[model samples]
Target: MAFLSFGSKRDKIKKMIEEEKFDEILKMAVKDKKALQALIELLDDSNPGIVGDALLLLSNVLEINPNSTRSHITPELFQKLMALMERKNPYVRENAMLLSYKIIKSFPEVASQHRDWIVEGVRRGLTEGNKDQKGFLLMVIGELGLKELRPMVEELVSVEDKVILPFEGKKWVPLGDIAKEVLEKLS
Candidate 1:
């Protein structure tokens, strides 16, 4: 078993991610809080490439070790992610929202603590954000608004702007479907 040494964990983990060594990264990040912190720090780096890789790695890490990461959640981390959501980079925004969903699901306290603020922020994005952002915000809203389905349906059911979400290769997901799904959750 390879142990993750401290101090250089950021560069090492970034390399491992670049090399597509997800299994190793997951093991080390799940076991070492320092490794997790390094990944989190990457989110603040000036390099968008590093930030994207860090977001991907952090989301995957949270999935693999949710129990170990409850203590890692903080208002600052959430604030950074929320800021990332407002950025123009599609990868950055999607991963940030996805990671937020993962963390909220793992710790109900996150949902209770931040759901209203997050939902409202995303709702605001629906009108003010760009195309890609509107789609991501709607998807995140779908996941977060389950308990307030009636209000969510009332507010989002008429949004037919239809953001195009392209997937790998020729695939794509329609944002309208997401809106429909959110309404369905209300039923």
Candidate 2:
């Protein structure tokens, strides 16, 4: 059956994602590792829009059923995701940060094994100019409860500026306040 051909579903899922068919992609991906693999493969897509669409689809699948979603995220997939945080496309980087946070939060044991990589991402996010990305990374750092990073996050508390945090609605929050909140949770 053509429908059951190897890589056909993954290819179809990839095409659907590129076409912005998120609802269908979500339906196809929720419990299917091949669908998940398609999303992962799209992370390296040259088109940022396609990559963003794939990331958003993965995020939706994770939110729908984190247990099943996390089970499909093997180490190689995890590494690929982590590497996207530094992608040149701001949209891709931001979405990757959000998805990475969800994955780490839902799969702590797996994330723990990638501590150095996470820390590297945090370090880059903090040092970078994108406040929105910084905000997302702060959430991950807080969830991680890395005491060693307290000082790094603590440094942001004195800055009297707001960042567009991707929370309920990409709310503008004081960077210092968000950092303070993360520090409080860490302590």
Candidate 3:
């Protein structure tokens, strides 16, 4: 009984993912607040690989069952995600932003209710120098489809920091130009 209460199942989920047992992982996570909490806790693990895998699984689970997943998506969770998006690790930050976007996209009603929080989160994610994350933020902004982001989008209009992003294999493109393209799409 003590083992059952104190044991971790994250390793199992990771293993299942390794074995391509997505159905099993989904069965373990979907509509299960406890499992969701466990997955969230896994995000804090020191291993970036573990954290990335957990984020991917969580995103998949939430996408499949947003209505049920909503119970676990509180204001605190969103705030924590905002912080995660600023992580030094680009891979982790990318996964975090992707998961955050999935949550907001799946539940537009929640974003509508918490417009201020979501907008602030978006602003906070738009840091300079992180070309990849800034691009991810742009994609999230597009997914959000919120006109309230106009001010934040305008803030990028004058940014001259050039971040070379890979395109078509060998072609590296500047982020400043991409920002202009995204701004045009927003308009």
CA RMSD per model (angstroms): 4.3, 2.6, 4.2
User: Better model by lDDT, 2 or 3?
Assistant: 2
User: After superposing candidate 1, which stretches have Cα over 4 Å from the reference?
Assistant: 1-22, 146-159, 164-173
lDDT of 3 by residue, 18-137 (tens): 677767777779856667677887787887777877787888888788776887777887887777766777667767877887787788788777778777766766755265656666
- Every model's TM-score: 0.75, 0.83, 0.72
Model 2 lDDT tens row, 33-89: 788777777877788888878888889889997876766677677667657766777
Candidate 3 to truth, TM: 0.72
Clash count, one per candidate: 0, 0, 0
- Which number leads on TM-score? 2
Candidates 1 and 3 compared: the better one by TM-score is 1
Clashing pairs in 1: none
lDDT computed for candidate 3 = 0.70
List lDDT for all candidates, in order. 0.70, 0.77, 0.70
Least well predicted 10-residue stretch by lDDT in candidate 3: 164-173
Compare candidates 1 and 3 on lDDT and give the better one.
Answer: 1
Span of ten consecutive residues with least summed lDDT in model 1:
164-173
Report model 2's TM-score to 2 decimal places.
0.83
Residue-by-residue lDDT tens digits, candidate 1, 1-187: 9975546467777777678787787788899888888889889877777788788888888878787777779878977887887767778876786787677667766766876676676666666776556666655655565455345445655665656453332125555566667666545
